[model samples]
Target: MNTRKILYQFGYRRCADQDRPSPARHPVIVVGAGPVGLCTAIDLAQRGVSVVLLDDADRIGEGSRGICYAKRTLEILDRLGVAKPCLEKGVTWKLGKVFQRDDQLYAFDLLPEDGHKMPAFINLQQYYLEHALVERAAELPHLDIRWRNKVIGLKRRNDGVTLTVETPEGSYDLDADWVVAADGARSALRGMLGLDFRGEVFEDRFLIADVKMKGDFPPERWFWFDPPFHDGRSALLHKQPDDVWRIDLQLGPDADAKAEQAPERVIPRIRQMLGHDAFTLEWVSVYTFQCRRLERFAHGRVVFAGDAAHQVSPFGARGANSGIQDAENLAWKLALVIRGEAPESLIETYDAERSAAADENIGHSTRSTDFIAPRSAQELRFRDAVLALARHAPFAKRMVNSGRLSMPSTYETPLSTPDADEWSGSVRLGAPLPDAPMRNGHDQTVWLLEALDGEETLIHVPNGGTPPAGRRVLVIGHDLIDQDGFFARRFDATPGSTYLIRPDQHLAARWRHTTPEAIERASRRLKGLDGEHA
Candidate 1:
């Protein structure tokens, strides 16, 4: 998409906090205005918490960065009331095909089901997403977005964090009961606190060229390994909105970084790949990726999320997708802790769960890099053998590393109650509730996730039984009908099968038969208020 067509700028406006005798304290001050930061602020604002979202820039970013939005992220956007614009303005795809030497290895379907509210993935430019989020933030009365406001200094104390925010008018002391550092990878707050990442920076470089063209290519992820056009290197192609296409060509370690991005150097490469000269270059950049993250996401009163706390190689589209999930994971718990509804120690689970997810993304990305740009001759031979065998050998197809597309991480956290009964199926503890199509009492179609909404919920699939009292319960047989067998087959639903889900829609506990006492116990356990656990 042409950025100038949708370009917008926010002017400087003095804040009440800036004019106060002593800077007024906010319930939460988010230290960036990117998609992750904006989502975090909106999530908190929806829960009735006051938020100040600050960013160093006055407008959306320049390039079409992070075009792939996983289904899980789209669900989160639905909760924020901004998924409609994204679905209307983005390209949706699910088929992924892998090739080697101009030959097809195999194709896989990400979401091969019939009853889903959202698609497997949507390819929307990063700037478009930021615009949608900014609009949603403006709708919430509790959210205040401060453009061109940067957090240059941070001090963490025993109780809260105080920040030095610099703006066009002047610098001011902003005290926040809690701080969210969603700045970019070069996080100023992280540097102010003297924290460094720990992991490896790959030696290979890749070029991202966003091209505008009219082509007949289907909306599918096409990954090539050692293609004839770009001999002995990898290339990836994806379609974005407004006829914009994202192309990534792997450059070996020996490539000259400065000269590779010149129009003269880039245009010929495009011509060679497309066998014509009919495409216009939109954005171009050479990037070297790394697999790294902080030792911990939570440090005292200043907690980190998104790129500020972790980073991954661009393969797999994990960077932005995982960062959005981090915002969802931290938003509810942080809001609860601030409201005194949950123990302070509950914040530690955010670090534990998302750190595990970061490690998983880094592992997948690191392996994809190693396979695409092998570090040694032996590894190259192994990759070649796997590619050759993938044509017929089903086992070898799983070995291809064209970036394992992003998926929701099944967390191993302290909040989940161990399954007390013998459950069969993919229902795991601490996993996000898999979505299904359902019908409400009015006989209108709805989604399972949307019915639960953004609050702690009780789901009961009854077998000619009524729901238990003492908690708000959604009885499936009465409140809604399972239009499809997804929930029934997945949860192995029987008479009185019950589930307790957290505010973020993750499964906290389950049983074939549950009582009011069990529901209260699980609620306490989810908040980290259990006497022994806390």
Candidate 2:
């Protein structure tokens, strides 16, 4: 646990639950205070669910891990009221460059379009993101975040679960109606449940050198395959906040992990890469990654999220972003289930959708890893040829993989109502709604996600028609004023076009010309109240 800066620390406090005759049963119990766990607790607490968040560590700062936060993650953070601090502190970038040796083969824009609030991604230390979530959690009275409270043991029952939590003094028991396992990849809960977390385990290793240097390198993601400085190995460079730069150098499968992380070995590599010794080593570690996950995310009353449910190469930047999405998808459905508004089967969608998402991420990460570290001579030659061809051939640019960047997952589940009418739009029925700038009722310009704001909203361009009953409808010309025609063009919207957006900002259904009855049916179907969605 080497950290350049200690950002957050909390003292251990004895709770009254330890002395209760019967274990205090909470509506929801969240394990691990990492980004995923904190988000799960905050989102549920905001939905008015009583949550108890437990973490083994007394402080947040560790090595600067998982620095790349995607734009979709920031939008989810915005809904939790904590995206401002992250955006303010993190380094923003959308442009990424791919290189073959010393030559730049290609560059890509993650967010080519405009009118979005957040950038393509931000390189912020993991501790900063955790600190922001912890600060936001303190504002919620119902959310109880306990430091040094670790779930040492768990017992699943028919009604719920009883957990044995270990603290400084001793141990205590807790009963929870539902549990969220967001602990890291080495999860204690996953082991306790007898679930297998086996998948692709990469043999090659990489060394992370976090150096503090006052350099003028523009904030962008730069990846090199067979770079001249790293001896025919891959390397990545990213600029972070506070003049800290993150460098990743590929070490072969047989490299000594312990020796490679030492300052004696790491400093020379850094000097060679930068051609200067002015930078001070802030933090260093060697890691071997994998693309693995459990068979399913949901197991009875306990649901797994984050690294606990899935593991992927950090180069893809899918680990933390997908975990945040897990919190969003599970929180809304779990809230509905706990409130008796939706059947217990709603939880099934969480497993189905997130498991599919995990598979997609694992697939991409595996391919990226294979391409970056070719296993055979033929594979190496193919990868090199692709990199060389990418300089001119547009199709070859698609073949070159320097880690396919993180993107939001589009769920293909029964919950989404398939498009009934032939329409021309980039957005799909189950995909997330593309953001656009619009004017609210107060005549203030806001992002479309902000206007949706954690509610099941109906965006209707009025044709002198009223929307469905029992749903919040935002009239395009009235409540939402679309200027520059970005929203209209993106959604293929017309005067009578209608869309049903879920609470998580995903499109549930849409139509060319729809009635109130159809919208109501789609709403029910989205909630698992009707159709095969249940």
- TM-score of every candidate relative to the true structure: 0.97, 0.98
Candidate 2 lDDT (Cα, whole model)? 0.90
Q: Each candidate: RMSD to true structure? A: 1.7, 1.5
lDDT of 1 at 232: 88
**RMSD (Cα, Å) of model 1:** 1.7
Encode model 1's per-residue lDDT on 78-191: one tens digit a residue: 999999999999999999999998899999999997777899999999999999999999999999999888888888888888898889898999888899999979999999
| Residue pairs that clash (backbone atoms under 3 angstroms), model 1 | none
- Number of backbone clashes in candidate 2: 0
lDDT of 2 by residue, 12-120 (tens): 9999999998899998999999999999999999999999999998997767889999988999999999999999999999999988889998888899988788889
lDDT scores in order: 0.89, 0.90
What's the residue-level lDDT of 209 in candidate 1? Answer: 91
Top model by lDDT, which number? 2
TM-score of candidate 1 relative to the true fold:
0.97
